[model samples]
Target: MDVQILFVDDALFMRRVIRTALNECGFENLLEAADGDEAIRIYRESRPGIVLLDITMPGKSGLDVLDEIMKIDPEAVVIMCSAIGQEKTIEQAVRKGASDYITKPFKSTNLAGIIKKYL
Candidate 1:
């Protein structure tokens, strides 16, 4: 696909897993950020079509990044990724303008499906 996607997570392993999954699904235009600051910087510079953001990170948390992205572009498609039992945080993220969310330990097919939904 031509659409660019931003994947933000503090864990290198998690980023790699997501990248591998998306790559298998034929999504080659992907970007990665280890923390929220970089994610925002890239979002500002690149304006990607979608963002797969981890809810908890070392700095500036995913929710904070989501807020800023929403401010930058209300129509931006941001899908939050969080660990299990973060329903409240997930709800808060949605309220802050996240397009959708996926829990951690997600299946590759499900992740690809969600991205395709926005596309």
Candidate 2:
């Protein structure tokens, strides 16, 4: 499919991993943002079909970005990424309008499955 997928994370490695995973699944239209600010900017311009966001970051946190993105596009399909034991933040992200949540150290295949279901 030609659906646009966006990855938002502060970690370069994590973003790279996500890219490779999506690539393996035959997804070629991928975008990336390293912080909440960049994520929001890219979201507006790219209007990606799905957004995979990291919960913690140096700048605007993912939760804030999620809220802002929802305001911009209520139907924005955002999936919050969290490390293990961050259930509280993940729950809050959901409440803030995240479409889904994925635990870190994820399998690319698993992420592709989620994207397929939503896309």
Candidate 3:
């Protein structure tokens, strides 16, 4: 409940859906970013407890942001969320220190479960 979550996605609708899902789960301290740059800026300033990051965006892919965030704080919790479910991509994310990976079009309960796992 107290833990802050950052939702990084390029789509406004996706962000809204994620927010609504988490809100229903009683996660009120949520931050959002429409792109990688803004996500990085917000992450640096706020240092949220958990980050739900998307892989695709206009600039600076989610993997790039993940690398930067890891450099900033090795212990930071970052979960990758994207429609791309390629095995190689997931492996790369995990290798880069992602806490977990969630494929898009996921159920709200599943997302909540993942978030709760890390918290």
Candidate 4:
């Protein structure tokens, strides 16, 4: 099956940009959510092969979603995305269960390389 990925970001533009990059990089099954709560719901229902989550959001935070997912499945492969200078929060996310973290405004090749390593 095509590698499935669920991308969660509060910014619609960021989501679209990520979706486009993943699509162009051979990931055909991409799902997106605008917030962590929706991300949790989608993740529970779809159980995608991978997840790309943004750290800062309006509600329930990506870290919160990561916590929930880890509770449900310790083996879940999650990648945290954050802007520069959010080291503490990102580190907390890593401790919570994220397999990797990426910064915002990342190059498509960087994303593709990380995804390749994990998925």
Candidate 2, 1-119: lDDT as tens digits: 79999999999999999999999999999999999999999998989999999999987999889988999999999999999999999988888889999899899888988888896
Local distance difference test scores for all models: 0.96, 0.92, 0.93, 0.91
Stronger candidate by lDDT (1 vs 4): 1
**Residue-level lDDT for 52 in candidate 2:** 93
Please, what are the lDDT tens digits per residue for candidate 3 over residues 20-91?
Answer: 999998999999999999999999999999999998888899999999999999999999997855668878
RMSD after CA superposition, every candidate: 0.5, 0.7, 0.9, 1.0
Model 2 C-alpha lDDT versus the unseen true structure = 0.92
Model 4 is weakest, by summed lDDT over 10 consecutive residues, at: 19-28
Candidate 4, 24-63: lDDT as tens digits: 7888888999998899999999998899999989979988
Off by over 4 Å in 3: none
Whole-model lDDT, model 1? 0.96
Give the TM-score of each candidate.
Answer: 0.98, 0.97, 0.96, 0.96
Select the stronger candidate by lDDT from 1 and 3.
1
- Cα-lDDT of candidate 4: 0.91
Q: How well is each residue in 3-107 modelled by candidate 1, as lDDT tens digits?
A: 999999999999999999999999999999999999999999999999999999987999999999999999999999999999999999999999999998988
**What lDDT does candidate 1 reach at residue 91?**
97
Task: Look at candidate 3 and give me any clashing residue pairs.
Answer: none
Q: Which wins on TM-score, candidate 1 or candidate 4?
A: 1
| Candidate 2 positional error at 70, Å | 0.4
